[model samples]
Target: MRHFLRPTVALLFAALALLTHRAHPAEHAVVITTTSTLGAAAQAVGGDSVSVETILPPGSCPGHFDLEPAQVRRLLACELFLRHDFQSFLDGRLLANGVARDRIAALPAAGGLCVPDTFVALGRAAAEALAVRLPGETEALRTRAEALAHEAQTRGNTLLARTARLRGKPVAGALHQAAFLRWLGLDVRCVLPGGDDPTPGAVSRALTEIRATGALAIVGNVPSGRRLPSTLASRGPPLVMFDNFPPSPRACRLLGHARPQRRPPARRAPRIAPCRTRSSPSPTSPSATPAGHCWTTSRLRSHAAVSPPCSAPTAPVRPHCCACSTANSHPPPAPAVSSAPIRPHSTGAAARRGVAESA
Candidate 1:
């Protein structure tokens, strides 16, 4: 009876210790991240032991964001600060004033996409950073990080398999997410200029690039183009739009995760030859290729390079170019292909619908 009593008393003590460990919160480490994706990674890795905050709002562009004083104070007080190297160093300068400099951690410079692999990588980085700062919780943080990484990698693999059909499709994109789209196997034809409305010349150049590439869809940040839709593939591809970023750790709402009504495929064979107009031409600029009849027409129709009004009087449009010679006298080249064109990155900007498969 005495021996049994001793064993029961030992068991009771062990059980009580276990309960205390479970019931009490561990030391909490406050972490600050530049983006929500990183913030979520920190949260996943930190689990119940860390507090995570992101300075940037969801869907905001990193290039345009500025740090506020309150955020600066929070940043200076944080136990750990995580960011991607591509993020502006302005925040770093603010945090590096003293002993706080040691707290700053940057994941390797990457495209900073919200892909599953990216999230997993970020998780690993955060775990490693926190392990250094809070050595007591090292084991738990590492375990959580590994679990997150494995789960993310598994989902990423599935997404790749689902989107495998999109490979080699020529698509235009904003410079911001171009690398990710290319990784998904889309032939990125041209990278659009980033930020708000571009100038007329910029728009014209974009049009020229699109015509040159014969891209079928313009996949990019929504609101990328200045005078798109009407001036863009009006008679061609429908604009495919996507929002900038997911608001949470969950997969993007559209793209591979959700079944947004798929845009019907438009199969087109654009035959517009590249046109090189001189500042001033003597009647004979390059003519339509032997394979083409007439190449391009635009809303701003009359440039010198264009031929006179279309002989088809009631035709929907006439040809035009500025300051060039037209010898064959077939109307100036009208843009041959109607393809979807996407927009550049803007936080508040209504971005394009994503490839139906990405961040």
Candidate 2:
């Protein structure tokens, strides 16, 4: 009984210690990112060791976003700041706000986060930066970063296999979205002009390229395409828009894990009714003229040559070729051809000469 009591007491103390560790964990490093892309990469590598805060909305255009005073101050106070070089607006603001240059880590603006290789590169860069700032968790961050990169590569390969059917399919897309489209194994023939509104000449050129390459669809992005969507949709192939940012950091694993939405079924064109006619005389018959028939003269001639009756109506009247309904009545006779010589009209002097000649 005394030996069993000692073991139970030891077990109780171990459980209490485990709960205590979990309840009061180490403080997380404060990470600030200008965009969700960088924030996602940072979080993916840092995991629970860092608390990531994104300055720009994931859906907004990163280049055009305005940083508020509070956000600027936050950037100054954060343990680390990650960003891309494309946000030139931040250069002046960060300098004026007295934010240390060493605090900010700039990433390249190359391929989108959706690409597996690009995502892996982003993870590695993020891990390196994080490891430098948080030296205590360097090994853990590096390990997680490698795992993340591996997962992205595996998922991307799987996606590539699944999208085998779409490989080499021609597509037109926005310049910014070209990388993602290429990653999806699409053949990007041309890119649209940059900005909200494109010139008519540019639109014409894009249309020409689309026709030449036989593009099945035009891919657009969420940013800077205000009028392009409607214009392209009205004049070109179907437009599909891809998002630039993921909804969450975890969603940045090349592509989100969510199942794709099913496209709506296509609408079929209404079928037309077949034309019907009655039996007619042979082509040799003089009365086989097509003056009253809805069918063309050549068609009537061919029908007369065969001397077979037209097909009978099998459905409602919505004829595509001709509008004439079933004709049970006989066809009208052909006009007579005369061989008489021409004569002058009898009037005035000509009338007197004509009377004399007749007499």
Q: What's the number of clashes in each of the models?
A: 30, 0
Which tens-of-lDDT digit does each residue in 1-359 have in candidate 1? 99999999999999999988654535566777775556656766776677666665433455555665556666677788887777646555674655266688887635425344555666678789999888888998888777665555554454455456677877676665466566556788887665545456766777788778877765445323333433454534433333233332211111111111111123423211112221122111111100001122211111111112223221222211111112132322221111222122453344323221112
* lDDT measured at residue 69 in model 1 versus the true structure, 0 to 100: 55
Model 1 residue runs over 4 Å out of place are 1-27, 91-93, 96-99, 222-236, 242-244, 249-359
Task: State which candidate has the highest TM-score.
Answer: 2
Q: Provide the overall lDDT of each model, using Cα atoms, as 2-decimal numbers.
A: 0.48, 0.53
State which candidate has the highest lDDT: 2
- Per-residue lDDT of 212 in model 2: 85
In model 2, where do residues sit more than 4 Å from their true spots?
A: 1-26, 252-359
TM-score list, all predictions: 0.59, 0.63
lDDT of 1: 0.48
